[model samples]
Target: MPDETTDTTAVAEQRIAALAAAHPWVSEARLTPDGVLLVTPHPRATAALPTPGPLVGEHLAHWEEVYEWTYETAEGRHAGDLDLSGWRASDTGEPLPTAHMRDWVDRTVGLVLAQGPNRLLELGCGTGLLAHRLAPRLEGYVGTDVAAVAVDRLSGAGLPRAAFVRAAAHETETPPVRQAMEQVFGAGVRPDCVLLNSVTQCFPDLAYLSAFLHSALTVVEDGGTVIVGDIRHAGLLEDHFGRVERARDPEAADADIAARVASAVAEDRELSFAPAAVQRILAAHSRTVRMSVHARTMAYDSELTRYRYDLVLHVGPAPGTAAVSETRQLPWPGRGSEPLAVLLRKALSAGPVVLHGIPNALLTDAPDAVTPHDLRQALTGTDAAVLLDAGDPRMLAVAAPADRATAATARSLRAPVGRLAHEPLPAFVQRRLPEVLRDHLRRTQPGTVLPRIVVDDAPKGAVR
Candidate 1:
């Protein structure tokens, strides 16, 4: 077998030579984009140059560094010789031929096709996995990346259905690439769908990610969809399992194991987002936004790996619309919000209710507020009850002392009034609001009933 260092040096030399041949302007190459050192006639003159838009030049600089690292240099060895293969294999996995990432790419492509594809642009199109999978189903496909090597590789692979462009994430705002998009697709050639799968999380900052999103919106047609599949946050996994296993010691271990696997896969990088935050950012560009998580686990090298990606589907206005109106509304549950909550309460009444917004805080004001204990008491006796927030008068009816005996005594006081104290306000309101009003109408008028509740004006200072 060839010595690892010798093999790596040969590979690096070839890569450096290739990069130099392609981009003659590059002077000194670093390992990453941030480390790229461009040689100019005057160092001060280069510093005085106008700031480039987004991070185009920065991305190019990183590409140069990656190129240099691939070369056999006397100073330092390239980690890519080991890191790239390891990362690629870890991402795609062995025996799969492609990386484990292909599974996610396939899933995302299926989603895009289901949405109805006219044209599509995939940002950070690493290896063109998505574009290749989706090209056959779409009218046109374009994939762009910061690395010229990726573009050349995809092109050489004969992905004739899709065109590969060497453009950085920040360069979409500039000419050339933007102009090429306009000329190829015509004036209003916004892609019907834009796929950002496991891509945005790679960005070091939210500003870069937001800028990419903003630029993407310009080429995305109204009523188009943006599909984002990436890890958002790691703490969410801890919170999720911690709450689920609080009661049983045996079950807690399983939760702990799962959390560890999730943390390992994510590597503590903040990639996941609360559903509400996803909604807020997407809402500005689309009329209706929907998000769902497809959770799965894989075993590799005797280690369990957990994969969960938040899939956001942003829908623009239908073909004919006078205007696209944006509104702040409750996030719609994957199924139905109200029904899901009601069923959960009925099945697991004692369990702590965990609420998370679609992205951040788009669904409800108190995204993480646990159901109050008073409401839980009200829910025990009756099939359901009206749920109210902290300020509602109904809340006053259930507020009791924290002691078990005191709470029991308070429950006794409300029993004669046909009210119970254990039900959650949100859960009760979700389940019984309609039925309660309907029954009230039957008693008020024997034969006819009003379609919806009608509240008479309350006197000034009267509690609702």
Candidate 2:
């Protein structure tokens, strides 16, 4: 008789190849001698994948369909889904070190209860993990998610005081929130606590967060606490990545990071947010907000991990109260107006520069923190310019349009640099401009064109 393991491998490989061939998105597939089958999705087809069910609106592009499909297809084996072991696995992000998640969860439960909430609403509560851990302790509890599977499976599985619903955070007045409110206070009362735990990433932008907040406030009683927990902040991304890189030996760090990336790819999930932007939006909207750094946002971790923030939004505080952490935008020139101007001014301050470095520097502190306004700011001012050789648009990440910056709107930047003068450059500029502005003066030879910045090139005798 043939061995069971050998037969299983042969069957698995055949299924993999067959599936790859059948899927319209699968661009290529190949099997290695070791029985490992590799499959690649067509780039465009993969990008166009949308949510499975009817959405609130077609306009909610990124959040509406992107998350719907992502969560629905997520396998139980993926980190943060149903994999308790993977929750503290090595080579991933965690609040404390992987070993300390038990303590973290316990502490989080304690902190949440400390708010003295009688009836609570939990948004984005994955797999009812917290409910399993704390439902018996609560008077009444409710959970919600965008994934229908999670809702259908756990809707009635919780304690007598608990229930689950399929709902999207960005949707206006979701049924879950209404049902949750009813469960807690019959038909006439609001929830004492509305917990948005590890759910901010599901939102596409700050506007959606603001919308969600408004909706939550409408259904929440006065003095009710809206807890935004387990926020994966990008402000400390570099610092955290640096630490994770240092924990393992050099080779191990590289391999570990590679493994982490592979896992993210497999799950079709990616989550990142800039703490600064989050603070700014919250400050402009909520009067009182308290941020606590705790809990593992990413689920997995290396030996050491850092960089997730838990925030409490005190909807309506008592007589004398203020935000625990009040954030304000910097008073930098051209501050709120345009991003292109700000980017150029900052980049040129460092002398001759590259357009890519400006946005990259801005992101060093917070991923996706640079908004449309910031990108517009960089292109609004003409203080200086960057030089670079034009190549494939893909090579210049900015040229490819996405949700962040509208690259097509900045088409003027693609013009030959020599003909371009003091007109406001786009958020990004690329030409082989020399290190110094004087590089242009040297290119006086016939048919020789060079790109360079013009820092007050007006005849010195003509103006001050």
Candidate 3:
């Protein structure tokens, strides 16, 4: 038998060909867009991504042990196993019920809304910590995890508004999740918000996040929000090392920082992130999103200042508008403000705006039109749409409903565009309108600086 891991590229390809031949429906077997077969620049970074446990079995004996690890019903207390926090603070110190943990949970709940979203589904529902807390907020809430022990415990406690289920990672066992979701809500029910709070850290790689995100897109209803909550940036991990050293050695608060981090590298749980990684992935789908930065809060009696800053993201627009981007990773092309762009921003502030009848060529390009890749990149996060007319002049209009208002907002951007605007916006925008036309709209307009972000207004939505 051929060893699967040791197979050469030619051998792997030949096997794929044979497998395709045996399957009649196999149109073609292919690699991913990023060429998974071609390169893995940082394999070790995502190697230990979490999987199902508590454990994966059909027998009763395993569950009995799962129960033993977590609960001492005799003592009426929670314990080891199935709880994410079990190993997290094991070496830190005894629990004094820190305020930081509570703050984290409360801040997380705030994202679903202060007063809306009738239904919510949370993936990787670790111990239902957030689930139990959120029961009173929404009409229906579903929390799912692979650990049957945790599910069994939460289900037994019986929160009225929430239900817990045993389900594997969304990638490996998507059907089970869909089924469990149906069982909890009903056959045709869909959640308004899908939460992955502090969860993606466990995944094997960005590839897993990508697969699960696509799965989420299929499962979530249109205009429904997908909250990819509490993810790390490359900088967060660096900040953490300093905090860890401080915690471990109070006297050496000013110790050689680099050396301390090097010594603790293998002994500690290191974080991993790819720069602007999640944004790049979401860009491909064109889903509107708002990202905010979250830092860890501390309890009164806590002995540590842990390194953590949760990035909260809100995906899917209120009704219209989808977020786009300049590059796979960058949100904006850094083309600063243009006349029309500024005018549109003001119009949006007061209410929705519609451009007067203009040439359709500006959109679909009749002849000298707007189709360049760089041109498209400049228009990344606008909330406007193109009007399709059979023969009449085409127009561009904001996509929000008739009564649109500038509600709460979240925005993120790296570069300042005020200086860049001097370069001038492409002639396509100017072509849509005559140069002498701006005096009328500028009367009521207040200058507002728009940042280039996928979307805005959430926990981390205002991130720079």
Candidate 4:
């Protein structure tokens, strides 16, 4: 293989060409003078979903490509002052406000500092976003990533009490990482806090996350905290897609929007988890650790504030570190129930309120769910219909009856939309609307910040 470190124009074009081939949606790919490979997708590719959104595989091969490309772009564009945070605005594909990104960094720094850790370990450090901010404050810091570029760059940065390693998340206990950690902290010592921030979404699945956590908890100090930050919320998966679809085309018909949303959700390669899912996974280690969920406090109404959250795993049973308890419970509004605005106002006055099953507002007005009959009607003149009759495996699973499915089939039948061939549609009304509504409430109700924080004790019984 050619040297991965240096990329000539031809090499860059070849790499992008291969990536584009894997992604049929890509219409144009070009390398900028600065070495960033910019890809432009076909206009209708999202609705069409000709192929999966991005490449995903073991050890986050896809993310490695992305970060390598991103690092080059940031290095060229920003030069001496590099913002390695990777927080970008979607509309323009530029980095979001620096202050907003720093707000999150500051908050995370405070959380890790509050633990008073002598040593800190960050998995998927991604060019030292947190390492640069935290390395000076701690006695020892070890940052790891799959990207050699990041590790090599950070290694030369000469940050005090910091070591950079090229390792995957699950490789925490491996020889390379262990040697690096030993050099920083000392022999036989573990980090007081292990952080994986804005990185879990790149994880392949829940199994990968679980495996990483198992390794993380084992390597951290007994009373240390494992902070997992900027997690994409699984419960808001649909809402996230819906927002994207609407933003892509504000005037798109509901049917078109619905179709594209389904396609985007299906093709999404990033891993997301409901707070409950993460909590359940943490349960296995509950006997020793307490789990707490926190919402991003970023002032902007972007993806981070809208769909992402944070988790802090307090390792070992410390005397005063009990789980957060909900002080009140409130039912969300229905057709006949009190207005959502009013209910939220009431809930705000009540401290630490737990809102139950809030319906997703975006889907509230979405097209009806797809039934077999609806599918048969919608697919009447389409190629998908012929495939369905021929029992194409992709067409077999029609959306509608399944709670998670929507009119994915119907949407595809009408347009170039390709999302319906696999997954089915759920009820138009669903409990997936909390995060968006939270944003709405924030805008409509001044001084009303609903805490999306989730606090729960570890499962009833779990081993380390």
In terms of lDDT, which candidate is strongest?
4
Candidate 1: stretches off by over 4 Å: 1-102, 237-272, 283-307, 318-464
Over all chains combined, what TM-score does candidate 1 have? 0.44
Residue-level lDDT tens digits of model 4 in 3-39: 6655554564455445443444345544456544344
The 10 consecutive residues of candidate 3 with the worst lDDT sum are 455-464
Clashes of 2: 15
Off by over 4 Å in 4: 1-59, 75-81, 321-464
lDDT (10s digit) by residue, model 1, range 305-383: 2223334354543333222121111211332345435643543343222211222221124433322222333344533
The best candidate by TM-score is: 4
lDDT of 3 by residue, 179-245 (tens): 7667666888887777777655444334446556656655665656666655543333434556557
Between prediction 3 and prediction 4, the one with superior lDDT is 4
Q: For every model shown, what is its TM-score relative to the native structure?
A: 0.44, 0.46, 0.50, 0.59
lDDT of each candidate versus the true structure:
0.40, 0.44, 0.42, 0.56
RMSD (Å) of each candidate, 1 decimal: 26.3, 22.3, 22.3, 21.4
The 10 consecutive residues of candidate 1 with the worst lDDT sum are 455-464
Give the better candidate number (2 or 3) by TM-score. Answer: 3
Q: What's the candidate order when arranged by decreasing lDDT?
A: 4, 2, 3, 1
Model 4 clashes, total count: 10
Q: Of 1 and 4, which scores higher on lDDT?
A: 4
